[model samples]
Target: MNHLKLVFIILCSISLVTSCASERSDDDGIEPLNTSESYEELNISYGNDDEQVFDLYLPANRTADTKTIILVHGGGWTSGDKTDMTDFKNFIKDQMPSYAVVNINYRLADENNSPYPMQINDITSVINYLKNNEAHYTISNNLGLVGVSAGAHLSLLWSYGFDTENQVRMVCSIVGPTNFTDPAYLNNTNAVLQELLDTFGIDTATDFLEEVSPYHKATATSPPTILFYGGEDPLIPITQGTTMRDKLESLNVTHQFTLYPNEGHGWTGLNLLDTTLELKIFIETYL
Candidate 1:
């Protein structure tokens, strides 16, 4: 792997493994079933690139009222896959058995592909495919989104700005950067962070940062939102969540914000359960 990909992988591994260490136990030994009877499709292509595909699952008991939620994985916008969201997909199936799940892979940022318009466009294509084939899948066009970190950022940005069809009913952002223009990001001196920023094709001279930032794109018409943050997260500042929360409030947009005081970039154990419950409630109410 290249240096950037290696660095990104290590970062993701550490956060995902260690963040939830406190919550797992020897007794939590049962594993979720790998394949469900409700499998609708796998490796369904939405675009030209190999990464522009998704795995889809339907609830066995799905009906007219059943909804779908798209799950996007985080890897600092570069090194993650749809498989990374397997646990969250299982959580949704276990908790909300009536919902359909779409776990997708978008082209990661690299030397050739910048994240902003490329990633944003990929999500739009995925949504369009689902909407077009709703009958074949036996699903409603209304969709919700749950995403982590960079995925969360893309979810919010697309739902807020590019969802021209208004199919997205709600969104849940897990430790995503709501505002890239925040001083917390702009003033960062970390070399790795600087390198990552460069991949986005952003600079101080243009409005590129604001253009990609969900915080700047949110409007009164934005869909209902649920945001989760870790007070101690080293990557996403508490301000990213709080600032967006404040904006959503001022606009009178329906929303919820939760912060786990002791957690970092991610969490484990009961915190995961609580986050799941919150997600269920959000979907029940708005989606």
Candidate 2:
């Protein structure tokens, strides 16, 4: 494995193994700490409830008027934990201290099953959970979502189509696949890559494929959006971002689309930091 992917895998694994640790305040759920003026309780629930649950983090200094940020972790929709994304959540919290951060975990897919409505359904439940206890968290009905890759796909779909609370004001997607029908996927040239992608082969089924495609479900009413993609994202072609950007413009939803022409599935140093900064600033414009 390449250096970065190896590191990402290690970090993700460490977070997952430690996910069940007793909850902590401002510490990765795996660690412990005394509550302070800036950090408070880290309320968590098994998003699966009857099964393995996930965790949630809310800032103590926030108020009901404060806009919250819901973050989704990406591992090809099959292997990620909310606690794994604690790094991203804490980064945002440190930058925008007042914004409450809600990270989530959803079901994964393997040989026997493809993760489908399972994760989306869990997303719906999380939204409901947040609203039911919104008063206690001091987060407002106004919310924003940020996701990377597979998580990006979920954030966009949930905000655009099934936001039951109608609370998602903005969403940011980083290197998320917009069109599953791309030639690279539909007419895949790499045999090994194709096999890995089509293992579940749901895209061959019409309604089923659309069932998970964010672009297929986008409408004029979708919330304002910001997108960032590296020009060389192998799983997601440049056409994906362009087509979506064109569609959003047609729908006239406030949106911004950015591309790092030299980058790929993920970004690095300066571009990464800049993209994150942009999200913070752009979210403020709407939230």
Candidate 3:
């Protein structure tokens, strides 16, 4: 009878081990998350325009102190959708499951419409919407921003210049243009680039360029910032990141800047992993 009882206990232990292994396997790379721990709302409109919509992802444990990160996708302000931010949103959700995410779409620039006020307004509108519904969502008033390229530019501009309520706690820029009036941009002979400048009426006057440029707008009180740049990016000059880093330094603002030496407009492999870790650290530290 004692021997039989010992065998039964061993068998139960083995079953438990197997069940644990199966659960870990089911997780694959994503952390095992309770299905009830989070929820997602897609295509919530903030304004009348089709592009002025955002997707919200709320963690199950969200409360008034739960941090929220807003993601903006890059398409040179002429194209791109909130869908472009999915991988980024998923990465954040996977790494920081406690945080909420708001992925947004803004009006695209065209010959007839400039991106400046329209795109900037769209971002604030989304923020206002979130604030209006924060109680319903059970999220904190604190906000962080992570943006790529043109979207990054807008994020920086808004965080530095337009966040009147001081709600933005941190800002991250990936391959974003910082200085629209940089000589590299003004002197570049690329026709397509020139066309892009024209689309924003940047070539029309330096005043508009200064108005839209994040570097020109950054202040000492600007929120903590993390900037990523590619040394060889054709669309964005290295000065854009470097200059901003220098400006932030002069102002004594809390910031970090990473320039991948061999990278271009985007990264892959270990570079991507490095960026992910850097961003994780930045958000963890500030948000």
Candidate 4:
């Protein structure tokens, strides 16, 4: 009887400790999570960089034929992290429970590290990781990319500029800076123009800017894409999305564009819903 009592006491102690630790989040006066979605933290590095890490969000119920998507966060290729989009990723996972979404942190630019290669290299590493781990997730190699702001530019340029093997299946650019040569942007009398060029300048006489611009690199064979932008986005002029859509149309590439006359940078309510639905449809069609 003594031995049995000791064992019972030990088990009870463990249970209490577990319960206390589990309640830590709520100890700060928070409620329980309404929905449960499982996520895994992963470390990916090209070299010996300590900050090279990413997070992958997987639906709790694994899909038999899982689809994959890679998310690139926007900070003009100069700043940002994978965790910035957790809320959005959660929203997506709730809506489509069969897709595995990846949020990535790419190396940012400095004097030595130009945008020419680092951004695309980070994306390529992510694709390679997915391709290798497809079996683990039970997902197909069919992939898509979506980005906001600077992330939008990266998504478009990488999808259109990169070859199909490293390419995304479908791309959605949320107010992306597409055509650098647009009359609105090319002729904007604002400091934003100079700030953009100042970041990518090899010299005044170089064509490297064009090389990185999606509009300059677009081809008829580019993958299907959906683009969204506000009519009044100050950072990105109207011509950016419209001109790119024009090019895609002329080339017969599959594409769609949505413009909200009263929104900016981002959207809310119906416009946001419309954009999200369009993206859901686009990915469903491809992935």
| Predictions: Cα RMSD each | 9.3, 7.0, 18.0, 17.0
The order of the candidates by lDDT, greatest first, is 1, 3, 2, 4
Error of 2 at 209 (Å): 2.2
| Candidate 1, 1-287: lDDT as tens digits | 12322223334443342211121222355343232346556778887788888888898756655689999888877778988898988888888888999999999876666666888999988888876666555678899999998889899999999988888999999988888677776665555545454544434442766787899999999999999999999878899999999999998989999999899989989998899899899998998
Counting clashing residue pairs in each candidate, in order, gives: 1, 4, 0, 0
lDDT of 1 at 91: 84
Model 3 CA deviation exceeding 4 Å by range: 1-37, 191-203
Backbone-clash count (model 4): 0
CA shift at 69, candidate 3, in angstroms?
A: 0.3
Over the stretch 1-287, how does candidate 4's per-residue lDDT look in tens digits? 12111111221111100000110221255432312345454554433354345667676656446667777776656666666566558767888777888877787665466655777877776677666555555556777888877777888888888756844678888877776545554343534334434434443222654666788888888889899988876567778888889989999989999999887777778877788888888888876
Number of the predicted model whose lDDT against the real structure is largest: 1
Which regions of candidate 2 are displaced past 4 Å? Answer: 1-43, 46-52, 189-203
Ranking by TM-score: 1, 3, 2, 4
Model 2, 183-278: lDDT tens digits are 544554444334444445343555645656677878888899999987866557798798889889999989999999988777668987888789
TM-score of 1: 0.85
Instruction: Tell me which of candidates 1 and 3 scores higher on TM-score.
Output: 1
CA lDDT for candidate 4: 0.66
The ten-residue window of minimal lDDT in model 2 covers 1-10
The regions of model 1 sitting more than 4 angstroms off are 1-37, 191-200
Instruction: In angstroms, give how far residue 211 of model 3 lies from its true place.
Output: 0.9
Q: Whose TM-score is greatest here?
A: 1
Quote each prediction's TM-score: 0.85, 0.81, 0.84, 0.77
